[model samples]
Target: MLWGCFSSAGTGKLVRIEGKMDGAKYREIIEENLMQSAKDLRLGRRFIFQQDNDPKHTARATKEWFGLKNVNVLKWPSQSPDLNPIENLWQDLKIAVHRRSPSNLTELHLFCQEEWTNLSISRCAKLVETYPKRLAAFNGKPGDLIVINRLAYHHWAIYIGENEVVHLDPEGGDSSSSLELLSFRGEVKRQKLTDLVANDSYQVKNLLDQRYRARDHYVIVKEASSMVGRQLSYNDDTYNSQHFARDLRYGEAESRQVRRAACPAWAGLAAARAATNDFSDRRLLYRSLKRLSK
Candidate 1:
């Protein structure tokens, strides 16, 4: 597992946990990194630390350490992940590191650290600026579409209420370590919104509401819940997470990402230009297009 933190200023130190992290190890990490990170970010002594209520994080020793250091800790709410903007950074970091496809533990560590450092301060500011929007809370009702920004792509989920969602998850699962590569096979899962999103920025988006009449909320919830244990075929070039969510909401499965990949932007531009009669010399244009394609 990785432990990282970021303020509105920018990212802090990102460290890999070598083994099972107990209270002592957790305290040690905070002792060694937290103050230095705060100093590096220039948060000053008044910045309040925010952390989940994990047992290790809130352990007696850990609390005492914070007290001794005169650290102020934010009283984070349970199951309310949307309040934390750092989760968005974590999501971006994971995507950036995974794209590198680290060969081993060494490369994984290097990539994680490098990517953390490479996170732009501007992006952090944007996340903080939009903090209020995320704070509107998971105001999504049952059967609403929840879209999580995954940097390069969007992950969709069908909200079933009570802070739970049903979504397509990769069969390979999330890589807790750099060794695991993401795969295309998918499984439908019903899990807490916080757990599924896990520090990622998300918004409740029922984009097709105006385009297509929505099915009854009860029916949508029932159908989505029934899919909890089902295994779904997943191919990036065909079906994917967006397709699954759209199917649940619209009764039709379509993947824009797949369509885009099939006909790339350049290919579409070339086709459109080729169809136009405005070109001075069609043969010259064709020759240039052929060379570009090559």
Candidate 2:
């Protein structure tokens, strides 16, 4: 296999590896290639390394080496290839090499080196420029669904495009009340997406329609809009934001009977078990939630 690093300016160093890479060898490559690249680009301490969650890349020894070097690495999403711009560069290089149709492994290596050198800084910069938009696109879309964890509770909302989401808020008071609650402070209301997500961790809960058949987008928005001024009673065991979301998406009330059986402190886990009916996998859920909290 081959390993390499690149930045917005161009390719850094390319290393050819004949076999598996262990933590020590991986650390050596990073120290040699990345450190030199940092110096060449004059990035110094400001350069942040990016790597996928490969076993060698994330091994304890490799992490310790990065710590000793005081190099900052970008926290990358696991199993997300599209988030890595270098993947695109790899694809381009592969295409270029294949077009030459080298007759032997030696020729192939030479072609790879030539193609890597030919990659322009302007092309790399364009890829880097798309990073922010790519992140935004990954985060959400219009009419997209989101689930936010607010400590012991979870809330649901529907994105309405342009950095805004509408959700059913119990604190907004009943539709008949004339008092206006503070922004995101009460009731079913529309709030800036940032405000809703502020100080909270969220997950994109949509796009799992095959696993949990979601309602039509128009229906979801209509249901959300209709509930805007209505004050829904909040009952942790029976009805709440989560249940509201379930009702809108699945047309069924979320049963919290199992959660009710447990103490409020353990309700989250109990509810998850009730929903999945897989006690053995509860630890996985806990682990995922713990990781997201960090």
Indicate which candidate wins on lDDT. Answer: 1
Give one digit per residue, the lDDT tens place, for model 2 in 1-294.
788877787778888876667887887788778888777756768788888788898898888898999999889766342356676677788889999999999999999988988999887887788767656655665556777766545677776555567876655543232231111223678776656655355667763456566667777667767767656654433455555655665555222332354456555654464445333212234434555587
Task: Tell me model 1's lDDT, rounded to 2 decimals.
Answer: 0.74
Please report the candidate that would top TM-score against the real structure: 1
Model 2: residues with Cα > 4 Å off, grouped in runs: 79-82, 140-294
User: Which pairs in model 1 have colliding backbones?
Assistant: 87-199
| Predicted structure 1, TM vs. truth | 0.59
- Relative to the true structure, candidate 2 reaches a TM of 0.48
Return the number of clashes found in candidate 1: 1
Output the lDDT of residue 233, model 2: 56
Against the hidden reference, what TM-scores do the models get? 0.59, 0.48
* C-alpha RMSD of each candidate structure in angstroms: 10.1, 19.9
lDDT of 1 by residue, 1-294 (tens): 898887778888998998888999899889989999999999999988878788998888889999999999988666444346776677788899999999999999999999999999998888878776766765787888998865344678898876689988754333233322222346789987766776567888887677677788898899999988777655432456766787778776333533455555445353455555433212324344566686
